[model samples]
Target: MNPNDHRAALADIQVTAQDVKFSTIVCFLAWTFAVYDFVLFANLLPVIAQDLGWTAAQTTGINTWVTIGTALVAFFVGPLVVDRMGRKSGIVIAVTGAALASGLTFVAGWMVGALGVLGLVLLILIRSLAGLGYAEQSINATYLNEMFSHVDRKNGGGASRGFIYSLVQSGWPVGSVIAAASIAILQPLGGWELCFIVGVFPAFIMMALGKKLKESPQFRARQLVTQWRSQGHTAEAEQLAREYHIGEETGVSPLKAAFSGESLRPTLTLSAAMLMNWLGILAFAFQGTLVLTSGKQVNFNDALTILIISNATGFLGYLFHGWLGDRIGRRNTIALGWFLAAFAFAGMLWAPNGSYGLVVALYSVGLFFLIGPYSALLFFNAESFPVETRATAGSFINALGQVGAILGGVLFTIHLSGLTQESAAELISSTWINAALIWGTVPILLSAALMLLARDVRPGRQS
Candidate 1:
């Protein structure tokens, strides 16, 4: 087999079990708090809107705009930061940026008076900086994929990687819960400004912990080749490339390489799938409180309670999907989960009103399928690409997902604004309900179909 760019697949890095444990802990906490920052913005925006004189429509607009900036920032982080810098640097900067975003929210309202509407612009700009943190999911996948590749190489694939990475990916639900629970608890005590300020601490702490992270061995190896080539050590570079059995694309742009040749199909497919899945996320999860509160008898607090409970179920789903991916395959696991999620969500929508117990049950089930597969999704996405383009591919697809978020947000704003006050009040009766159905269900199913187009690279021991 030319060792054929496969020898460096796992890069015989000297990662100890302790290194894995330590990196996982750091990634988990960083992602957890990054999510805390991300989810908190949505949950507390109503209060922030109230304080800032924005209508619900305006709040949605702000979210959409921020997502645009977030997509830009996320793209920059993946290719410019993660690809250009080391993974360790990328992760550290991500958490630190999230901390900065959360801390700056307190001043966003004050800017309206000084910068006029541009004050709000400043707020969007500030929040979008957390896009780096949002991109942390990609960093975790690439970092851990490299780390996990070294283990059980004798086994056909890195059997335990998906399951272990699932533990880190659970940061999403944990952070989401923390965001909601903190708002429930803290909003009354001071204000959302307090919550925003409070949100900064955890991310900052995680950034400190991220400092302890060792660079991924694969990344170091790649850098060594690049360095050797740059220093005119062409023979050394070629020899190392030959030794590792990898193609030497030393100076090629990772993003460009990601789109060329065989990388092109998976890149396009994965990007589209994430875009569709994220549309679903925006419709159901991002605007979760709205979906539950609309046309239902539940108050905001009750809706919040349901969100807290339902999202907790995501933690279990991650573990289960992670475990399942190890046996069957990460790609298959993601597809099955998302496909089932469509029906479960349909059941959620179809159930009769006044059945709060039934609503909660269906909603939770839907989320279990919807959000759970992500535990496998990130790792699968990472492994699908060659090492050279791993971070770029992950980030590129992830950034594309924000396009779905933007589209979903715009659709939500249009639908919500079209609703008369009375019509908007009814959950099942409004065109808004159809909006939910389209964004929430159809996109999920499509994303699942797209995943089937994926041809994943199986794990093998480093040559």
Candidate 2:
């Protein structure tokens, strides 16, 4: 074997256990806080409007603008920023900015009583600003994948990644629960402003963590490449490896040239799969729990209760998918998840009225598949790209996922508006059930087909 390979083999032997634990905790908590902030907007929108005197159209408009603003910014600028700044710094920017924007949005809404159109404009401004920060979720996932080793990635791929991911991912449900409960509790006393006010706190805490987290080791390795070039070195394979603290130079391009050619096949495939997966999630987020439980006669608490259960169940599913992904492979786990989710969603369509139990079962199972396999999203993207442009690749793919989120919102509003008063309840159920079935099946089929194209960069192995 060449000296370059010898060095790489040696470096692998020295990786420590402590590095794994420390990096995981730092990465996971940062993600949890960010997701919590994002989920709060969806959960609390109704309460925000009820207290603020906005029309339903206005409220929907606000969300639409925010989603569009974030998507546009993420798709265009996100890759550049992430690739330039690297993961840790990019996450800090996303979390800190998002937190400030969220807080400012509350302030803007408060001013609406006095500022009139100006106040409403300010609310839009702040919400849109928050959207920019929320867009960071895509970048941070790349950071998480870069920090761990390959075996750790494959073995603990689901467990280590899943458990922490589930906890953070659970933030969606937790945020929903918090929003639902807080709005109900505070509406009589402080009004909707209280919900926005409380939502700001998590962002503050996230800002604190963002301050101290380390850059991923993979990032450090990349930094060495620049160092070698600047130092008047020849960029010899072995020399580059030694400079980067890598055992062997591996003769790999840090900017990931491999993903540009035929490798683009897998890239496009996974992107499509992830796009559908996220679109389904967006669909679920936009309507699932709320539509299933809504009616003039329905109790708000009952609706909230169902959401809590759905989110809680989703948390467990994230863990299960993670473990399964490590043992069985990401594609198989995701495909099976989609199949189960489709059946459950279909059940909701056919189940009898007053059958809240059955509705809950159907929705919960759908949520499980919706949230679970996707937990490996960051890992999957990390492996797909070469280390050089890992952040860019992940960021772009994630931005596409955000695009799906925007579509979900639009689809939900269109469907909900089309429902007439005479057949509203049945229409609601049938629409949601149908929507869920559609989202559950098509995306997974696309995802499974794409899986056949994967390079299986299951960590430790050389591509």
User: Could you say which candidate leads in lDDT?
Assistant: 1
Off by over 4 Å in 2: 1-16, 49-61, 76-78, 111-121, 132-136, 150-181, 235-238, 241-259, 295-298, 418-463
Best by TM-score: 1
Clash count of each predicted structure: 3, 8
> How would you encode candidate 2's per-residue C-alpha lDDT over 125-221 as one tens digit per residue?
6666555455565565566566555435435643355445444445445545555566567656776565566656655666676666666656655
lDDT of 1: 0.79
Compared with the true structure, what per-residue lDDT tens digits does model 1 show for residues 1-463?
Answer: 2343435533543567678789989999888978888878877665666677665567678899989998899888878888778888988888888888888976775676578677877988998987877898998988888767643443345657778888999999999898888888888887777777766787657667877787776677677676667777687677766643457764678999999876898899899999999988887787777677663446678888888888899888999999988888878888999999888887777777678998898888888888899998888887777778889999999899889999888877876665543443563345545777877789999999999998865532242
Clashing pairs in 1: 5-245, 5-246, 295-427
Model 2 lDDT, residue 98, Cα: 62
Tell me each candidate's TM-score. 0.91, 0.80
